[model samples]
Target: MDPYTSFQVPTGDRPKYTGKKLVMLSPDASMKNIDAEASGAALRLAPSSAYKSHEEDYIKAFEEGDGIVFEKFRIAVINANHEEQIKSLLYARRSFQYEEPERYLYALDGPRSSNFGVLLWQMLCRLFGIKKDPPEIDPDPAPKDPLPESPPVFENTGEAYWGLHALDTLANSFTGKGVKLAVLDTGMYLAHPDFASRQMVTKSFIRGESVDDINGHGTHCAGIAVGGTRGESGIRYGTASEANLYVGKVLSNAGVGSDSGILAGMEWAVEEGCRVISMSLGASVEEDSNYSNIYNELAGMAMDMGTLIIGAAGNDSRRSQGRISAVNHPANCPNILAVGALDRRSEIADFSCGGLNPNGGLVDIAGPGVEVFSSWKTPQEYAILSGTSMATPFVAGVAAQLLEAFPEATAREVWDKLVDQARPLPLPVRDVGAGLVQSPK
Candidate 1:
């Protein structure tokens, strides 16, 4: 059972591309020299011989397409009309006939029936036996015995912070030295004293801005992931103290970003040989809807290239008020690790999101997010914040440590290691997944 089968789009209305749709084109695998420019050229210059009518409009749409071409995916940022979308989808399907994603279109407005003609096209292909049925969803397992809450053990370790001490970072001496980690979020402030010894690679995907911390979210996340040196107060935070940091300002100073900027940042990180990518941003989505097929494909390619991506599950849910929400976009995708939040008492944070979807959406692990203390922007060099955003980089920093420990391990292997070593908590799997994410021993 394909999990996506559960998502039912109302056919009463045709899909509309109200704004720009991020279109991902499949790469021509046969062409060893198939580059983004070449692929874009193919989509732009090649005659739409498949169209029996309205060829001029289709050519015009391709000519007007403006976007980046990656090694495995070509993102065509276009204000698509119905005809243009249908023709583009058809071209992609015809070009890559086997194992292609069912859909390639993503609307910034939302997932509308009219935007996903490929779903209907997929059914047509099934009727002609061009594709096999997607893999069935595994039935939910019987409830396992609740894991016993592990008692907290406190000791002086470095800054003696409970979060880092719990993971035994000082004892293990796994500071993620020499590993390359990327944090994709608002931005980073390089003038901070903690990062003075580190050489960072930075980029700003948000238009008309430099990679500098302004909204403080990305700087905070970067501090948690890789900020080194003791603060003026002598608190030692950040797990990967020595890891090479790559900061991409995906979100703008107003703390907002689009899917294109985020996607472009991911591509740039992977191209820079980043093994661990941390994202602390997302949009609210329902349980029934899975992440975009484009994100799933991009994550798949990233994993194949030895990069592990982690995202915040979301912070929309308030379990204390009996409100529980599904994981957020991109994080809901299977290949990306969805991190939930935990309080100092080792309990689920009230504001942390959960794994609510019976099928594809679920939290992968837990991290210290509630009232978590870490570096912030200047003037106020420290702050305590709570959200799945705070939790995600903790996991990413630990992932960097794992990469340093197991230098040759693939992304999947590192993921398995984290799950296998997690500290089991007395909580439901839906609330806490495989328990709190642990550090490399």
Candidate 2:
């Protein structure tokens, strides 16, 4: 019996969570029942509509338990911000403890994560709430982990770098020259030879600001975009090899970060004049937040000023994709292109998200996402891995190529050209927007 309240919301503007209690109906209750319960309490309805989907935005707020599935879109209202207030007004209301947000936190976008951290707790329990313990992630369960020297040229096979051909072709044409790319994952190793000539712009969004590739994912993506292979260590063929590089440390050495840190990274990338931004991360959101719109519009503005944004569909191969299942955020925005995965065979990657978006649109495009090889930060190793993560750079590299071919083209034009030149798929045309992006069209 969580007390629910509502407020009027403008139609086009996305929701900016205002530190109010947000509780779902009892597990067994239906939307109809929830509506009835609200009516019985005589709580006035507040308009709670956001133009953007909040699925990916809310992933950080609630980690699922074995028996819970609070992922559906539902009518929600804001009530008082205290347990006493909730109890006094609503009969038999189940209470979400109100507490304050963590003091150590720094957010990239405050509007998106306002309902989480302390704001969520304070709106319910009215005190600095004690956080529930996080589930422990075990150490070393992967089939492989780099130990005592990683590969110098590849991850799965030395052949992973073949994707390098795509980036080089774009550079050969000069589209990527001087463009700034911000890698917002794990930190980058300052000594990677390929970036020696690059203008390095770095920042730490997390605590203990170390801009090092602790988990190696950032290094891999960076290598594909622009890295010095063994023989050409002096002159690498990167997607935008001559482009400036900015490394934003959002994800930690473990490749994990909070929603705010990631959002902050986006803002920083835009502020740095990066022409292209790529993300290999994913999460869930139940409500749209101001943070989403701010970033979307920022990217839109970037597109207007010549920036291209690309996001990985995610590596969650499970058929159901965590719940509110669809592609990841930022990429799902109409203005941004969402990339799904595919393998060397050119088939839809098993982990790829396919279908019309629940929010009314098709997921964007597909690319060569599987088993791609690229440089890693570990002194000697490179890797061959799969994920739309691997696919996104291909698109970015192609965008760089578009810049070279059509130096005067807008970001939208470059994206349009990439789609126009895409190879048609035998399946899921709606799920895979244009076509698989090829190199240097």
Which candidate leads in TM-score? 1
How many residue pairs clash (N, CA or C atoms closer than 3 angstroms) in each of the candidate models, in the order given?
5, 41
Model-by-model lDDT, in order? Answer: 0.68, 0.52
Q: What are the runs in model 1 whose C-alpha is more than 4 Å off?
A: 1-18, 27-65, 80-92, 96-142, 149-158
The RMSD of every model to the true structure, in order and in angstroms, is: 14.0, 17.9
Give the poorly placed runs of model 2, Cα more than 4 Å off: 1-160, 164-175, 231-237, 285-295, 319-325, 358-361
Clashes counted in candidate 2 amount to 41
Most lDDT-accurate candidate: 1
Q: Write the per-residue lDDT of candidate 1 for residues 305-367, one digit (tens) a residue.
A: 999999888877755445677887878888899988876657676666678776667899988
lDDT of 1 at 48: 22
